[model samples]
Target chain A: MSPKTACFLVIGNEVLSGRTRDSNTQTLAHALNAQGIILSEVRVIPDIPQRIIDAVTECRARFDMVFTSGGIGPTHDDITTACVAEAFGVALRCHQESYDALNALFPEEAFNQARQKMAWLPEGSTPIKNTVSTAPGFSIGNVHVMAGVPSIFRAMVQWLVPQLEAGAPLTMCSWHAFNVYEGTFAEALTTLQGDFKTIDLGSYPFARDDKHGVALVAKGYDSHAVQEAGRALKSLLTQIGVTPISGEPAP
Target chain B: MSPKTACFLVIGNEVLSGRTRDSNTQTLAHALNAQGIILSEVRVIPDIPQRIIDAVTECRARFDMVFTSGGIGPTHDDITTACVAEAFGVALRCHQESYDALNALFPEEAFNQARQKMAWLPEGSTPIKNTVSTAPGFSIGNVHVMAGVPSIFRAMVQWLVPQLEAGAPLTMCSWHAFNVYEGTFAEALTTLQGDFKTIDLGSYPFARDDKHGVALVAKGYDSHAVQEAGRALKSLLTQIGVTPISGEPAP
Candidate 1:
């Protein structure tokens, strides 16, 4: 059977408007890879309520787990918490433990209306540990809501990935050769893909300041088959009259 | 009036597998912003046919224009052309001009079957110029297909964005201050947002080398409103006892 699937919702106007380049998707991808969960899809949307609600509600039902990043802060533009709650048809409430804990972090008169907003979560939601900031992320049902900050989002993924159900971890073996054109070896790569029923073979070309090459990668759940494919990849590179490196090509 | 909306589809197994970081989305976002088009959403999916067909069909129906990057090459994994054809219910036909142009780039023995595949496009498609590579990208209806490579994708966007309908170009006015917390001034920022009727005001915080600050940006099609918001943003920062710097904070 295939592994369980996960979908990531990157919610914010910054990404959609090109004000920020997102790193959370890459971080989540690697973390899920380690957890053996297939990250089936990712969606980046603006901080609009209807968009967030639609994506959160739709992905939660389609995938095994859903992760949402951004718009969870204590500001006016931050509306992810309310939107997710609306998606689940639940009301937002103050979790006593979270409120008290966060309240203790600030001195009297320091915790304003905005800071207090961070303590409020969806009904019956459980707080995820937040080591970077005082405000904690929350998980309600299969939807995990986390901060938009790269550091906080990464921390939440590290803590949450281990808790999810795992399947067979993906393994990869790759070889690279410089001064080789990809089209010349496309037929061989296609045959290799056909031969290895379980493996997903890929040819990725790279061009440096002067050097050009292709990285032939064999990824699969079966480690032995992936290794055999790696050997074949190196041999193919050698037959093309180029020295083969045993891993990804250098920058 | 709301600007024309666009959506981006990042198609590749490399991005979904965390093997490559995508830069095409940012390129498209900036390009559309210049054209005064609102980038509504972005989706990253693996190179699966069903996913491609579904996204292509769905996005074309929802948004004014759609851009797809990646999976157009001479390799077996490059099946975007065929999938796009299926999405439009059209046959794949070789464009004679493109075929002859690409075929002439290589010697008779070197132009193999794999290399020839790049010339096949969806029926009734228009070719987009690709200066970086010999293979031309294609435009079918409102969906524009481009190469995944950063340079090639950027070139394609530059060539295509001007041909589309022009909207009011998005303009911005921004000011940043040092050592000002976003939450501390959240109430004021919210009030400012309420006052700026025509501008979209945003507050973004940054921390670098033991320094923390917030960048308040005012963006809109109305240039006058954005400039007025910028002055107010500067005054707000000065009122909080921090020196305000014009434009984005130094990295």
Candidate 2:
């Protein structure tokens, strides 16, 4: 199956200002990768409405699915929902189901006025159930809108990924050798990468005390081809006078 | 001094495809923070020239300083120099100084052939000397363009930050409590945050061994004010029937 492409729009001033370390990008990348969807881009914009609208429109037009996290809170800076609606040329309206859920989660005095903002949704957007929070995330077109909080974002992504079609996952295998230099293995690695047109070989050099080495990673969609290429890599490394670590091949 | 705001543009198809995990953004964020410049946005766009132009133009207009990483390689995908030139309404041409530096790094045969692309620069842009590599980074107006490789990007940032105007660095202090529930401390923490108008307070809840607690972090430009607010926090926690951990008192 062909790979499906996805993009992530992280809307928050906190993340860009280094006030918040983003865990959502990593979470989305891993989840999408596991589902055989290639996450193609990530853009972190501020709470600006125009910026959010522009990025959302561009990503949705370019990729199979576009996911956005953050800026759904009740604060003045929370404008993602409205911006998204504007991007899709839809009207912003209160989602009754979401409002009812929020109303049920808190006292009438505490939640009535303050939590109503969380229920605001774009016209024709379907709510993506939030198992952790009463404020439900929403989906419109191919764009899935979720929370910025890592835990909530994770839960929402898990709930949403299963509903979409997934492509075949890329298979990857690696071999490691210590006490070797990157320069020593660069030529062979480049040649192998050239020979295997479909496979991508990554050479990662790590620092170690008397144990320096390169981690040769082979990545592609074909499992058998990757394993065969890995064997060839091992043979090449051995011929080049490098010691290979023996282990069961990764699945 | 008001905190200086900066933004980063990471231009690369590799990053967008998740083929490369971005270290450039984090490195710049940390380095800029140390120099008292707050990084306010990071946009990762593909190698498309139009997107690069749009991101650079918009970011430069919004922030005090704009930094761009990636798309400076020798490959055909490297279009940042030309796009940046277009964004600034300048011309793209080979830089003699950079060409000389590249020649010095390698023999003329190797440098003139493969590394010639490194010599291209936006007309009238000043080169930021790269201590690690021959491909010099450059700056035009308030936008600083650096390489994609982590080591070189870091070196360029370190060299570039000191040359720019820096605002006062924000001082950060934290108070941690063990075996205390967030529900118990929520009210007190909220009160403390309101009382400290200058400080930005963040309460992070964590679960440990089935116990709940929070790590209260206070950040601001005034060290004395943070300490004062921290003292009030410890006092409030103690009054709320929680034992203070060692180092709980304001330093």
Candidate 3:
């Protein structure tokens, strides 16, 4: 079966303003990849309602699944739930179950209008339990809206991933050719790609630890093809008089 | 003057495939912030031509500037320059200067069709010299095409930033209150935000060094306003019975 593709949307004004560095996209990317879901796009957008609605609407249609982080808090800036409801053409409804759960989790003194906001979700959506925090995220159609807090987001994802459909996991291999410039191996790499059409080849150059090298990676759904491509890449490096290491170079 | 807003488009299949983690977005985010530019959005897209063209076209029109990284290498997957040219409704032309530079850098025997592909750029674009590599990235309209390699990307940005007009630099301050949760100070923060209309306040929940707390950040173009907001936040934390540290919590 073809891989189920996914997109991650990180909604926060703080991220765009450079006050916050988004680690959620990276987290989702790795999580989705391990579960055999192809994470095709990651967009970090602000708290604008129109932008959120448009992105969620478009991404839900384009990809198999859409995971969003942030803007689900009890602050004025948290507009994701309402915007998501608007995008799906659904009304925001106070989820009775979520409200009851939140009520139980917090002391009566602490349960205020601010805390009640977490109970709202798009109509026809189901809640994804947040083990880290009592407030739950919800899934409507293909969209999963989770809290911006990393722990809560991760916890929700862990609870939710197993329920979704997964595709064949990708097989990958790499060769780190030390002291290699891409210009030197460009022609050979191109030829190798032409020969192995199924495998996706990536050449990443690095300058670290006072040394420079290129790491050539081959990945595909077929393990044998990936291995074959890696072998060919290593042979090409050998032909060019550069010894190829098995994995990423140090530093 | 208001900060010139920009967006970064990271065009690479490897990044989406989870084979490579992107550092270019964070690098550009900090660089743009330091130069007083607002980086409003960042998208990690695949090597698809239409996706690249569409994102570039939209971002270039939306923001004052668009900076793109990756897909500028000498491989079949390298199509960012061509896609970017298409987005601007311009033809890809063989940049004579870049061609001559590349020719001079490479050996006559090694200069092949694959390596020669780097000379192609959108018509009416100016080359941004890559000191790390001979292949030059170019700027067309409001978009700047840059290398994917961190060292090369940073170098190109360093060379190009001084030429562009920058906005007023933002002033920022942070307070990390130990044992504090967002709910404890949510009301005070809401009030503080209402008082400081121009400043952007962000509350981030962090779990590190075996302690969990919320870090409140205040940022604005006006230094005095940001400072005042920081003081208010510190005071609010104190009132809530938590001593707020002046900076980020220890990781």
Residue B198 lDDT in model 1?
79
* Candidate 2 chain A lDDT trough over 10 residues, lowest sum: A203-212
lDDT of 1 at B202: 83
lDDT of 3 at B126: 95
Looking at model 1, the pairs that clash are: none
Q: Candidate 3, DockQ to 2 decimals?
A: 0.58
Worst 10 residues of 1 chain B by lDDT: B204-213
Reference interface contacts recovered per candidate: 0.58, 0.22, 0.48
Candidate 3: pairs in clash: none
Please give, for residues A1-251, the per-residue lDDT of candidate 3 as tens digits.
88999999999877776566677776777677778898888998977799899999999999999999998877666789999999999998899989999899888988878788889889999999988878889999999999888778889988998788887777788999778778788877888899999888888888886788888888888889989998998998899999989987765
Superior candidate under lDDT, 1 versus 3: 1
DockQ, all models = 0.71, 0.23, 0.58
Q: What is the lDDT of every predicted structure here?
A: 0.87, 0.74, 0.85
State how far residue B180 of model 2 sits from its true place (Å).
Answer: 12
Which numbered prediction scores highest in TM-score against the true structure? 1
Q: Which wins on TM-score, candidate 1 or candidate 2? A: 1
i-RMS, each model, one decimal: 1.2, 5.3, 1.9
Deviation of model 2 at B35, angstroms: 4.1
**Winning candidate number (lDDT):** 1
